[model samples]
Target: MPYPSSDTPAANPSPADSRAARLWEALPGLSYGADYNPEQWPEDIRRQDVELMKEAGVTVLSVGIFSWAWLEPSEGRYDFAWLDGVLDSLADAGIKVALATATAAPPAWLVLKHPEILPVAADGTTLGPGSRRHYSPSSSVYRRYAARMTRALADRYGDHPALALWHVDNELGCHISEYYGPEDAEAFRGWLRRRYGSIEALNDAWGTAFWSQRYGGFAEVQPPAPAPTTLNPTQQLDFQRFSSWALIDFYNMLAAVIHEVTPDVPTTTNLMASSATKSMDYFSWAKDLDVIANDHYLVAADTERHIELAFSADLTRGIADGKPWMLMEHSTSAVNWQPRNLPKLPGEMARNSLAHVARGSDAVMFFQWRQSRQGSEKFHSAMVPHDGTATRVWREVVELGAALKALAQVQGSRVESRTAIIFDYEAWWASELDSHPSQDVKYLTLLRAFHRELFLRGITADLVQPGADLSGYSLILVCTLYTVTDAAAANIAAAAERGATVLVSYFSGIVDQHDAVRLGGYPGAFRELLGINSEEFHPLPQHGTVGLDNGWKGRIWSENVRLAGAEAVVSFTGHPLAGVPALTRRVVGSGAAWYLATFPDDTSLAGLLDSLLAESGVAAPATAPAGVELTRRLGAGGASFLFVINHTGAEADVAASGRELVTGTQFSGVVQPGAVAVIVEDAPGGQPG
Candidate 1:
């Protein structure tokens, strides 16, 4: 469903139709726990896990995620004795269960029987069953067996008291997002026939006239396989869309069975909604889910990874339409995937968990409850490490759980933001295609840079879809939105014309949804709103930088911009486009529009953002020292909660009046180094006084 417009407020959930609300009502406080894998351990260890969960205030556990093989060792055979004991034990311990369908990994027996279910790479190599997620997304045989398994689980456990939610296949499309096998080709053709309705429409949409690539019929089309040279950009883009749709279709298939069996139980799949996981367009999939859940792991190489964490959490909240989401999976410490795999610093785990909660995550969970003794992820951090409960990780986990319980009132609250940044997964797929102005022009890079500036200044911004309601926002930032629909472009322009401060970065509005150029000049769709036109692009060398008249440096990109009605705010100094405007502003009806033609240095971008925020009348919740991250959440009856996270070594003072929930005392507006605080403000309104 399209998001609610400014005039239409999002509907509040009721007991009759909202399984998410039902699940939360069943739980005691804010949900806390991890993915519990009892199949990997013995009965004694499983009993010990129940005790530890109670001690740590764990309200829920995701079980049977990768237990398909254990549940069904052979074809048409079943073994539910062990799972029955596990679920009964969890229920006795008062822990809710997000029971999985256990279809993430097909059993070895099924794969051995049907080798055609395996996924094939673009290079025609078959991915075997040695790893997880090895099945082709479009395989009917795989879907048949998966649906059977889902039905069996739902039939047995649908009415179980411990079942709070139904977890769909684990992290759909985490690996093998695209397949090139015969089955995939057939499915692709069927999807195309349904989408375009005719072969001629497909040819026109893909612009196949170039290079004699026009398709005579849907049967002749295939996945964008490797060729002698670069494949058609539109074909590749369509394949990306098809791949995501295939996974969504698979998920919907299983969700249908669950809904039929248990109409009141919520169903969700963990989505990787971070910068690192970009294959899936989560916004398109959000409406199908009963609750939104996301998995995010920090990049070990980045020094300021916490900012990236905030970005991911905020993006997840945006996908949920400002509703509270679930932190489905995040490592407690170091992860084994990155090259270095450095362990997190002391107190970083608590800070990370609270940051997500501050950004609208109602539940806090980890990838696994106990560290594995042997596996690819054996070295990955978990709640219980190899050294046992005496470790710092365990202590912090218990402490974070108590903190969440104290802040239980924040569960249904919503994060407050008046500024929005347009984010589109299709645009991300198209912007970084084989041919572009610069390879350094990454969609996430520009997004992170802009978001980091706002983070540093203690401002909150929602990462919204291109077609989302823009009238509710005071400021809108469109960064590297290379491909957009004509309706979306008109919506953004209309927002600017109605008193919103709009900023358009370089390379946006250059193409349509079909990957075809908009025609005429650069940024064709936004020319009238921006009041500027660019004739040509001037991407700088890999290491080159150009001087700007504002005493800043521009890197990677510059354009020969011509002013139609906008006033020049900054210009290039000594390049081929010297004296041409690098930044320009124009007054649209009651508002203003700004255009940036090049990438600016951090200082320069920060200054420009400051001016934009001021002009938009958007300000931080409170003035605080550097390294203090502040966020606010609003609840019913004018209740407000302020989250203050101090990442610096020195003490920081934020101007606020409230009762701190963590320490259960009156807040003095002073936070200690490396500490986190959640305060219930005394003020009636959600905003700071």
Candidate 2:
């Protein structure tokens, strides 16, 4: 039931734990297939389709993803007769059901029956509801129906062997949180009481005196009205926190119902990437989930950069502490949501799938299985296409399935490497929320500067959680951590003391968890680690960055940095803020801490990071070169799966001595444009020989 639609809860992992044991048993040869619906097809077609799935070795079926209408045809009169039959059919075929809540969208019957479930928009316009995820997350009536519907389904089929996993209310966080509805206001008041205990505490934390946001009572507090320009920072941040917690509560309620009824079966909700429209505190829910799986879909070949997508994949892995996770939904050839839906050519799909495995994905699966006969996701790609498995996409899916089955134990295997990238969510939330020198200066921009260099150098950098232990890795990178938390700062300090080389960027540690400014200079919480006292940071436009004390020309927005114990490794040529130390290095026990004052463009960032990593004795993949991306996974064979991805527009030479997993033929030259090869080797082979 779990792996591939992955398993094993984070925060606790041991073979002795019953749930952990079940999850572990389920993970080996764990298979994933998207929601399958042949309900609309003829009997003969349905008959053959069932046989195909078994032949393909598909073990998990995400059933009834969009079957709201079929399950509840009338108000209070559920009709699971069809779904019962579908489950029976799949059970006969040895497939496990990741049951859907069927309330992603209420049936037209429910909407027509109770139109009050419709939600209002932020601009104060009532949206005429006839869509999925239309009810405000805080709507009482919607909650009643959702809970009732889920409980009924669970009670009905909880004991069924085919009923393996419960997917409660798909992608629970959608669009954004409620802002205008009456239900939202009520929920916000309740949440305030729970969070701050009373209006007085809330007032103190929000610093309500500045703009008279102080409330007389919990009931008196309402979601603040955004100004014609922008909402006040205190109010805005509270709202963001409120909204994220609001969705999490909804998911918790749904998961609770399932756990109460069928504790044996695993339960999970699909998580979206950080770029998601809704921001839920996943770190808070990581332990609550059966498995922390996400739908990661960022991809690029020759048209865009690979570093962005690669970082995304790494974050998904880090979400569950490198405990194997799933790629819940993917497009076979091309995706529907992007600005340009570019079909993956030749080896791209296989390459990307292996890359996820290289990162930490247990299984890869598509969004919708049947290629939706109706609805918005009808165009979404799947393993078995709309036209059936005759297409090139189907062949690729079959090939991938075969490969995964052959490599049965690879799903839950851990990847071993000497490089790691540190991402702090507080840092991410803090930097952007800080009312500072530049709102445009973001955590992502600095991360790109740091990771781009690693990608260019062919290093499989682990995207690690902020508080993760870094004693194993040779280097730990902290880039533009704007909101450095006390716990995270301690981890970095400890890592530095443990002899790890850390790279920190400007805008690091400027604020606290509440998005409040840290008082002592800039980078308040983390000032001591880098041994630099930063004063005012001037936001530099493109031209403001120029030559530094080092040979490389500093690019991107430059910050005016001040120093104390740490000296400038890279400095300005000859200008105000020039000799102020653009880059500084400090000794923290046995480790070294390097801080960058600004985000540098690709050329400069790569140059500086490469120099630092080389000096630290970190190793790079042998086949990697400029524009040739490399990812590796260490396996039981003492073999490392080295993935070579060429992001350039032209072919590049790549030399490998051992076997190439993608191609049977041997290679010892440049890798072509978009060429992906998984070469198995021993111990990274001493860095490209």
Candidate 3:
């Protein structure tokens, strides 16, 4: 039987897209859960866990994600007795299951039997069998064993009463992400052969002649390992691409087995930190998931972290194309891994969870339910903290659970944004190559800065891929897009032609997919769309600063920008290229294009964006102070909601006239400090009185 995961394969607007659709269609109302590890506790403790889960309003439990060792202690000797009892008990308590395939951590027996399956570091050190995810992604032997385990689990629990979703491996590229053994070398060679048909083509694309590092055959090429000197940029780029695909291929193999055995279950794996992770391209991986899921942890040390969290949530929602997703893992309080684990202040935990929902997450979940008594994550906070239900974390968890239950009306809703920020993994990979102009040119840092500007102004931006449907957005920002593919360039140009405001910042449109420059000039692919020409990249010294004619500072990067058919918008104040146009704008048909030749400071970037937004006739969500984030989600039949989040210590007024969903009071007042309020409006895009 064919499962109805999705009826259509278009890029967006699938009938069965959001997690809310699949989960709510099976079970009504919102989802609240955590990663359950019952095997860690005794049967008596597990009985207590069930009662607490009911009290906490947890409808779903992500079970068996790391239970492979317990399920099959010895090869071929199955033991589902304990799991069966756990599932049955949970079902009796009315809790559904997001059934994990349990392939994330293989048992010691398998790794000990085939040590060759262990991942080898780039330094030629083979990782030992002590930790989890030690298996090599490129090892065929590992795949064979993983597939066997997957088939067995799916066959046994295909029609289980508690099964709701299928989770494939935990955090695909956490550890063992990059492999450099003979197996990986062989795999890399094959990947290269597929990407570039002939050795001559490969050499030409890699520009191997620069360092006398030409390869005559594909077999001679090696996985870019720790070299005695600087490694080849193209080789490193391909290896990153190959490693990402290797993990994806592993997921596909497991998903095939689950589909064959339990076709009705939708498959997904948790994606972690899209801006931080380098190996996996989530935009590509999102297609495989019937419902996209992500694990987000805030930089609690930063005072403005809520803004970053909102950015991550918006990016994840954009990857799902406005579909509601799952917040698979987050901390109830302080996480243990950071340098300093600062517990969330009063009301901050609920604010963090609801921020995700306010953006577009349907399910609010965490890494673990109960805090561990022993392990590397013993200090990590949980739904039930170490102090039991009497603690502040517990009270907040219970409060968030009640809030989610009351949010049943908001289920299946989509958050819509007229602004988009283009984020490409390939561009991030290429821009950070070894021999770049400045080591300070971090891609995510700059992108996040631009995103924070829009966010501070109470505007939500979709973190879109280059090929995403730009027709839906009015303002598009492509910041530091150093690597430009032909298709990606055309997509932006087409968007500009269709009357969208386009902004291409410094260091953009410089290289192609092969890590090679687009020969004639800088920003070769996007010069025409931007209506400006650049000759070279002029990187500033470390901690260097320059002045912009608009009274804002420019720092870290500057380019020699000259006008072709566009008019100058901002010029350098005192530099060798003074009055040579720091920024330019061009009117293309009904749309307009603007180019910034240097990385502007935050104040400058904000002013530039303000001008652009005004010129494009786009309005912010209503005038509010900084640290107050705003977003709007729409339900079927004209139901609209306004979400106001105040991330600061000072109270701020949220201008709205409607019924507040969480408190059931009439809206329009000063939102409390470190608080969140959801108001249901009478019409979409309704302004405050």
Candidate 4:
């Protein structure tokens, strides 16, 4: 079949399709609040909770994330004691509900009573009690009870006035483990059967005979584990594929439970941005979801440099296949997990959220509504506080909420993008897991180097997946794609061949989905797509820096790249690898592809990326002087907005092409410390937002 399938667009979905769509229609006037645990609160406090939310303009509340203990008080007995009251109070407060599936954890009583619910890690170690998300996805007992609980919630609250959305199993990878026990092995056999149909076809595709992975029928197959590297790349790739599919199956079963009860309500699970390691194939769950939401967390605060966020949003977008999105979980303030939990100084939260909207976001809610007392996230910041309000974070949240309300019309609008970046977890995993060269060169890092530049320069970048159409985009970057199906590779090549500028990173196109190395040199399979053959590689240590051999040189890790249907635009200097191609560009069809062999500093990367954006006609924030930052988002009804923020401790010069929304002034230069400029326009070059 042709790539991306040119899918038949759905007929206007029925009202019975989901109440979730009703909520989307109501999105502009809505407000998003975070995890509310009325299960742990008293009636009076719960009442106060409603008032507090209303004060902050919170129109929707995600209830029951950790309410399994309250709901399933016993194995077969169910109690709606606290939950019923919570809903009644929410109804009184005029709050809509995105009811959680409440299956993230089974109560301790259930876990001890039924040890079968306990999960085993890939290494055969059993996860114990005391923490949530430790339950096994494939454990039959767990699924049965989880389904029962979902059905109960649906049957009871499906028609509730407060019902708006369905949140399934909060933060799906919080447990940090994947199952590979005998249970997984059993499921893998079944999954393999469905994927390849027959053992002969599977063997033919995997070339199993060479690796002794040959199976007579299906009984011989087992789930992939962290085992002998000597195993054939095909088996290894299959194991990874199996692992990804297993998680999807696990989620599917949970979702089935939700559908069984509340078929009219949309269901979705929140995935994290940095979890390529788990092989969560969200593509498999796209249509199954009412909305694709993700927790945007990164170790570094380089909002522009973190292409992972764009990748997350893009992948999330495609999962729903161009449907609007939700930033279901993100930090409105400093995150405790990073090495430096720097608070989002001033307008950063507003800026980052707008960036999501610029690409395509329906709402920008955070992970936490209130700070925790004690736990792994004890220090995580929240929009509200344990101290009963009056905190900087809470104050900022209030202000940000007001801003969102002001721009309500922009909420569900998607950017009609001309640029895209394909984010493949499979390719990321394959590049990282390879036995060859080096693990230091992370595929994601390579991708971010290009994306960060576009982000800071105020260019909209869409993150997409393999086989997605590139006709809508003028530029597409595919980084470190070590392994992919021929179908996917073909789509990318087709896009580049059709006048889209492509950036092909090192170590890409080296193998297939089965981990089989392509004939010829590196990026062997995509040589034609990229139009190059790497003759030699000049690998460098992390500290070994190089300057471009050109008149301009800077400190960066560089390598020599050979050119074919491309030009040696940049090369390394000062080291033995100096005077060789570090960067090359090739015109494919009517467009082009630029290849980078090794990692480089952000500064150098910015130059290359910015130059590309300029060539593509995407404009940067006009007057964002030093210490002042800018961004823009495409909104509904042909409206767009540019965000100009001051990041300096002192006042700085700001640029603007139109009137600012915050102050309604045509900004030129000189913005005060921590000040902001929100420009609203009509289209690409419309008014200031």
lDDT of 1 by residue, 129-208 (tens): 98899898789999999999999999999999899999999999987698999999999999999989999999999988
**For all the candidates, what are their Cα RMSDs to the real structure?**
2.3, 4.1, 3.2, 4.1
List ranges where model 2 is wrong by over 4 Å.
1-17, 39-42, 274-278, 299-302, 542-544, 621-623, 627-629, 635-689
Tell me each candidate's TM-score.
Answer: 0.97, 0.90, 0.96, 0.88
Best by lDDT: 1
Single out the weakest 10-residue window by summed lDDT for candidate 2. 1-10
Candidate 4: segments with Cα more than 4 A from true spot = 1-20, 204-213, 226-231, 275-278, 298-322, 332-359, 374-378, 535-538, 545-548, 551-567, 570-582, 601-603, 626-629, 650-659, 662-672, 682-689
TM-score of 1: 0.97
lDDT (tens digit, per residue) of candidate 2 on 1-689: 01112232445543223553465465456466666765566667666767877766677777776677777777778788777877888888887777877767777877777777777776777766566777777887888888888888889999887776677777766664555688887888888788889778878777778666677888877786655554456666677678777877887787778778877767777887543323565666566677766776654333443466676677776667666677776667766767777777776676677666667777767765656677666766777778888888878777777766655545555655566777765456545664567766766766755666676677767667677766687788887777657898888888888888888777777766666678879767778888888777777664556677666676555666778788788886666675778888998888888888766666777777777787578866575458877765654434456667776778877655555555555555567776666566534535321
In terms of lDDT, model 1 sits at: 0.90
Worst 10 residues of 4 by lDDT: 1-10
* Residue 658 lDDT in candidate 2: 55
List the pairs of residues colliding in candidate 1.
none
- Candidate 4 overall lDDT versus native: 0.69
TM-score: which is higher, 1 or 3?
Answer: 1
Deviating ranges (above 4 Å) for candidate 3: 1-21, 684-689
- lDDT for model 2 comes to 0.69
Q: For each predicted model, how many residue pairs clash, with residues at least 3 apart or on different chains?
A: 0, 13, 1, 14
